[model samples]
Target: MQSTLYPKCVLRGLATTTAIAAIAWATPGLAQESEDPPAAGDQVAANPNAIIVTARRRSETLQNTPVAITAIQPAALEAKGTLDIGDLQGTAPNLLITQQPTGSATANISIRGIAFADVEKSFDPAVGIYVDGVYIGTSTGQYLDFFDIESIEVLRGPQGTLFGRNTIAGVISIRRTKPTMEFGAKVETTVGSFGTWGMRGVLNVPIIEGELGVKFFEFHQQTDGYMRDGFTGQRLNSSNSENFGLAVRYNPSATFDATLTLERQDQTSKPYFASAMVPGDAFCGFVPPGACGGNLTDDLYTAYKVAEHSGFYKADGVTLDMEVGLGAVTVNSITSYRDSDESFYADFGTAGLFIAQRPQTYEQFSQELRFAGDLFGGFDYVAGLYYFESDYELDQSTFVFGAPAGGIGVIGHSESYAAFLDFNWEVFQDVRLSGGGRYTKDKKEYEFPLILSDSVKKSWSKFTPKLTIDWRPTPDMMLYGTWSRGYRSGGFSGRAGTPFSAQTPYDPETVDSFELGAKTEWLNGRGTFNVAGFYTDYKNIQQSTVITADNAQGNETIVVNAAGAKIKGVEADMSFEPLDGLNFSAAVGYTDSKFNGFIIGQPITRPDATIFLQQLDYSDVDPIFAPKWTLSLNGSYTIPVGEADVTLSAGYRYLAEYDQQIAPDPALYGALLAQDFSATPFVVPQNDPRVRSDAQNLLDASISAQVPMNDSGAMANFSLFVRNLLDDRGPSFAFAVAAYPNLWHYGVPREPRFWGASAGFEF
Candidate 1:
């Protein structure tokens, strides 16, 4: 018993390094080549300490991963001033994250023309978020700060294999920096125009040698608004956000490691003001109070004010992981727990003449265990068991002529349990066969005693499977194909209408997807490209319907499922360092999504209330919000200046406009684009609304210099960043009301040319 652990620790370290060396010998080309003959001039190998990710759960170079993944390293993100998830848009193609016109704690994320589209409490996101191996369930949970991150991986396509629930579209994986047996700290601060100020810092401290370590990170950002609220006389789009986190790591023995993390984010903001949805022509004339007449336009903007929102998101979790090498097999044990809460108010004008407030909160806990290793016959596999439980509650307080709506509340709860297994076999020197499956049993309970008499509970079970074949014809090229299954659990509607609200439950959405992809690296690793094509068959799709209620008089509406849909798309990404000191990256995506065998004349909610003559025509056309073309381009150049380095980066993004309505009446195609800000009328097709495009290009650039500190391995850096350096307002307002046929703004009025200089030291 005389300290036998010391000898075992030393032996294990030697064994691990030795095994890694042996693997390198067999592959000879894995990750070590960059260590020696680094790539060409002014080019550096990707951070040597970077944790390689396959996205598909395999171990491969980020540049060589077969799937179409865009990884933004922490340093790269910091360089680009991306402090939160919403800023990830310009860096990736076919990806957009925008806060609702009224708040910050919640954001709408779209990828390849697929998105959640609704911010309702029961809504599930099309893009799944995974942080530190834990799947955060909702879109509201996706608005956290980008603190102390190692990398953010955006995998485009249905990731139904390893990541299950809500991954029918794609997966976003965030890996945070882990505690190390060292002491280090970095701090930065920036001040810019428009009363904007920001600061962030990260620190890692070793409490004991090989025994305990702790890492801490925090950030604070505040900015003034660009618009003024007419009613309150306050800045309309002001914001303030604060985030802090602590992580503690304990290494009890040579093979045991455990970590505990506590994190919180406080965000408060007032968002863009909006007006009521208006119709065209004399549509609202049929009603006594016609639409878009007299004070309607002025009163609509005044009446439709979304109250300021305050959000508090706290996450406290612990993970216990142990890795033991048992000759040819390695045993890995991971246990985790997480809890999250989100509360926000959504204001709808028609529901409340003044303002309506809807508050929602979600609580969740999750745990899972995995075992992975290599055995005989070139078989590598990982098997796991998973379970999750969550509770969601919605409280509605409506104000019509300044009063509450009976103080009603709706509550819902969900419980999910699953088991999954994934394995891969090296069928040949150049080929591998992989397969995985997940069986999930989910149960949900909904209770609206204040709105309904009886409670409702529904249970669903699904067996999702994935099959993939990967072939590496050459070490620099990988070709793969995958077929998988996807699912989205059903929930109750909170609307006050009939039939739909009477059912108490809806059907789950399911999809079957097939995909093929290829990744290739050429020009001596200076250039890499990825391409993928996918087709998905969706069933039991959910659509929001407006049903008139018997008791609520045209005000109460219910949401329901309409029919199925089909989606097909092709995506490509390329990164090329054509010459020394310059790097170019581009991403292009195309989506063809539409309804299949859907009937016409289905009644739905229209933005304009008074316009009555229009008929919805569902002919051959693309689905709403599904754009046919999306593209992004970025380039960076690094130049050596004396003893220091200078870097320059620029980026551009574009999206093709698509249709918002599917009216069957041919007359609607000639409807005018009578935005309130415009004096002229422009006619466009029903599906091509001419809204998503400004027909002009956007440009952003930055320049930075690095100055080294003394011999202590620290440094002071200076950087000046500018957005919209050309002073061209990107896209401003883009909608019109039937009552006010001539008022419109193209898009969000972006800030003008603003520049900031920052100086920081890292140790």
Candidate 2:
């Protein structure tokens, strides 16, 4: 069957990529080198394909790393205008990162079909985010701003053995630029649409010449949001943020080194515009008779009568890293401490029918010690011990019609201990076998003073393992197969309405994955292609459900262990530089995910007013955010003009339609059917269009120029960039709430087209 979502142009591009791959595979000798190579005077003669990465806790070239990873460097990030983590959505295969609706710093990141999108501190993120070897335990600050970053690596599959727990989906590793013993400074400013403006500055100072150095950086930005309040005509989603950090590097001797970093971030933003798809009964009374049937406004970016409170977030962190060399072995230690406070208000109904304010404070401390070096003649090993402890307090208050309805106060604590070891052995010529294992123990405690009289505690333990075999037949080609197991820690529900629900704990979810991959380079080092196919057996899935509670005015969200699932996918990435000063890259991902045994209990009421639970089967439902097809095409060309160089770059991405919800509630449909016999037939949740996201085709473009000032290595750079150039106003996130007599649907639209210009001077 032909797909309407895939345009002809995209199909042609895909075909071209396929053809190139075929030719390179079928006839590697026929590949020709670029006639005109880049000039030697070009800034930094770094080879894109040979970029270094630390996917397995060791530095290795990207083409030689036996993992499915994408590394983005400073130059590419600048060309693509990637400012934050959310801007990396389409740059990788089978990866989606979006900021949550109410929380500007919270990121809902999905790798493959696994995702977790809750703001509560009790819930652990499926994807692990690491910065300079320190793990971020909460989602609240995972959407980090990019500045002075050395590289960002997105690893596609499970990284449990190396990264420890809560990495069943994948891992995002961000490495920051280290302090240099040199005197340098850089300053940049930006101006854009919607009253957007920003400035950033970086300074490096040599404290003790080659012994000690320090780097300081600061960034500030503000924007008048595109969304506006429908009633007051005031900006609803404006944002402001400030970030500053300092890093000190001390290398007194070649045998030992230490680096200390202190950082802080402050952010304030109004909530995203939540548009009511179907007005609830309470909201209907406030509107005209006919106006209650559809949305509140025709404009997707407008919210009617939303709360006026803005969200605020503040965070402080400190990290210390020390490394000691011991003959054939090296010892590394990392200690980190972080604290954060956040307050946000959300209006789901958009008409003040239901409003909730959440205030939270969190703090965490972690320590890690690792030893890495050559164990023997042909074997290398890395072992680590990790300990983490965290505590958080949350207060939530709900209001209905400007009157207090219900709320909950929660205190939570979590502790984790882990030990891991990995080794690589070269058993034969150009062939290696690698294996690793991690044993993790997690303990969680929860207290809800308002609902529960006593606190609850639970503990879970698991051991994850990984094995891989790779063979390099040639210097530029690698073939590997891997088997790995990973898990996500389980915990109690923090958003529970009743004491019983709050005390109940859920089991951990696990995934056993098998992958086969090939990394190859052809065209005399001008073209590179990598492909991986993986199948995962997912068990004990932790699924979140919202149900109406008899003791509270609002619904409660609970996590339950569902039966299992199967996920399989293929990912391919290709980069080619067929001509001098021109480059093209393509990334394609295809995933097929389905629940094997998903069963839920649906409460049904009889005519006599008695309620009974009925078993409902939803195994056929597709996983959320698991689009069947995702493709990205990017190209850039540079031309030397006198003493300056100009570069033009463009990118296009396509995402197939995917379901946003697990499945439509059968009880809600049954209730509606009983009210009216002529109601629409019950469509399968997978086929229901109401809960599905539209296929998206996004385009972005940028042009940059760099001019040299003098021989002192001073340069001026300027760029103009546009995101969402076509302005596709599709809903990025949506959900339906059962409101007794009706189902109230709410949606948050994607950002519109935005254009910005930036200029910077560096020495």
Candidate 3:
């Protein structure tokens, strides 16, 4: 059942009241400390809320920026022992990050109930990921591991003006630490549960004092996995990865600077085990009754698979970033190129009745140039141009009952160009008017060599605009309202089951969003509270679903403009330091999303063996992955133990239940009824329980101590941490294969409890 744990009206009221109180209780003389905070690893600033950010392409205080964004510092990330992007799942509001089963390196991210999860390169991700000013074009490599990181920012809502295409939901920007022009070295090693162990090293060298510097870093890790294979009694979800990178910084003069980076990563892992959830299925009939059931068993870490497979991923990339300061104006350029290749096999039936393998290669190149300046004493503006191109080739083969069922090969190419201009004017003494517009053009070409003799091409263009009005009635508080639009490109389905579906093309999707927000610092910057309420009109959603087809392949995945939805949500984040060395923070997100229109294609077979689609209305179906309420609470305390500082931290996160599929296919149900399948007795519900993941509660804790090695600013640190403390083994993803007599259910479970300890040194 769809869960509405928190009422929408109550959440909205709470958000509004919080914002109003923050403005009303503003104190005087508390806003003069607007200087940027010191860099990471430096001394702590007096006011914790004075952190600087570049969310608008210009340097500004977080409290002064009108956008709703969360900036996570390196220290916070380290406290929780964060490894990859997926580890930040519950750190922000209205955010969800899950590693897909296809590959451990692939991430499925959703913000404000907007997301797209697919291995196909033709489908664009709803949320945009940017690393070091370069956009990551594919989900295959989006789950980046953390090494020498500076900051991570999660921006909620549409970032249309600055970030052009595929940003209909929002953007995640990650910045890596740069060379400091001084000699330094650091090393760390970790050992943890599931036979996990890793080591990392970083070195910095100054080629010329204050002129040029270089930094090198490497990381490697391996884990024995948690899930046990029933056939071989060996681990099925093991992983091993290695990453190395180098950065060179050249600052010949104060007016101009440039930094170049090169990186490579290699990884190997066994895909997640697909646990079957039915007893009468063909494959399940061969297994014991204890292994085949209608629901997940207590021993969720065991998979009854008959075969094992391993997958590998390799990636290489390079980036160049340059900035020129001209007194009143600044010019910046960013150029990047990245490529990756991966191959993985998946057993959809866990029992090995149906198996598939996909091998893909992807490459992308992008260049961006932007200029920022003050046109007048009270006017600030930024203009930019962007160009991006990407290409990918995918080969997929399937095996049914240990027999080859042919395969399909797809090649896709995409090119995009955009121009944008954003401006802010100080209309009044304490009020500002800001507006921006971005014009983008995207062209896509796709080819299916095994199915189609000719390639297909499509083009889409959109002009997204933003308008905002902000008032800073008091120096300690700011209130703003904004309206914006976001767009995502469309293309042909690469995993189409039939030739007709392969040749068909889908249209682009868009969203219109309205938001009101407030940012405030109270009690002399000892406390901070921010709140935002938004309503988004999501249109032409690119919904992907699995359906039975009348082709050689019984089932195929298709993408369509399935539905339009109305999504309304409220988000609030607060942090307070009530004591000298203690801090507490909380983030709450409430989303009320409903589909206004839903249309699905139902397969129908004619007497002549021809297959066609009959449009059906499924407007009552719930949206997938749209959790009603998400909450996170965290606390940390620090104590000065002689010359060393000992700190302890803990966090708790809660996620309400959410659906994984739109609705069961009516045609599949009818076919099962005709066959008199006994499973029909359990599948007669309008809202299938098999397609929903229940609510989850997660707990994590860590303790660490830092000691001064000497007066020369060297430090030694040791830490211990645990995640999923309660060992909640809930399914992160679930699905139903409702193809006639092949009816069955399968799901991927979340990782179990993990405990680890680490030690590090820096000099």
* Model 3 per-residue lDDT tens digits across residues 1-763: 1212124323433443344334323421222222222222131254554778788888777788899898876787787777888877777898888877776488888899998887678889999999988899877789888867888888999998998889889999999888877899888888999899999888999999888999998999889988777667777678899999899998765655678899999999877565556644435666545457645534456776666777999988878787665555567778777778889887764577667898888878787878888899789999998988888888889887778987778888888999999999999998999989999999998888888889999999999999999999887899999999999998999888678889899999999999999999888988889999999999999988777676556777888896699999999998889988899989999999887667665564433445554554556666777788888999999999999999999999888888776546433545434443232132323335666777879999999999999999999989999988998877776777643334456777787889999899898
- Give the number of the best model, judged by lDDT: 3
TM-score of each: 0.80, 0.90, 0.90
Evaluated against the true structure, the overall lDDT of model 2 is 0.78
For model 2, which pairs clash? none
**Candidates' C-alpha lDDT:** 0.60, 0.78, 0.79
Better of 1 and 3 by TM-score: 3
User: Candidates 1 and 2: which is better by TM-score?
Assistant: 2
Q: Give the lowest summed-lDDT range of ten residues in model 2.
A: 34-43
Off-target runs (Cα >4 Å) in candidate 1 are 1-51, 101-104, 230-234, 252-254, 279-354, 401-408, 495-504, 545-559, 599-624, 658-697, 725-755
Give the alpha carbon lDDT tens digit for every residue of 692-760 in model 1.
Answer: 323224456778877777787787777778765666543332222111122221124434566666667
Clashing pairs in 3: none
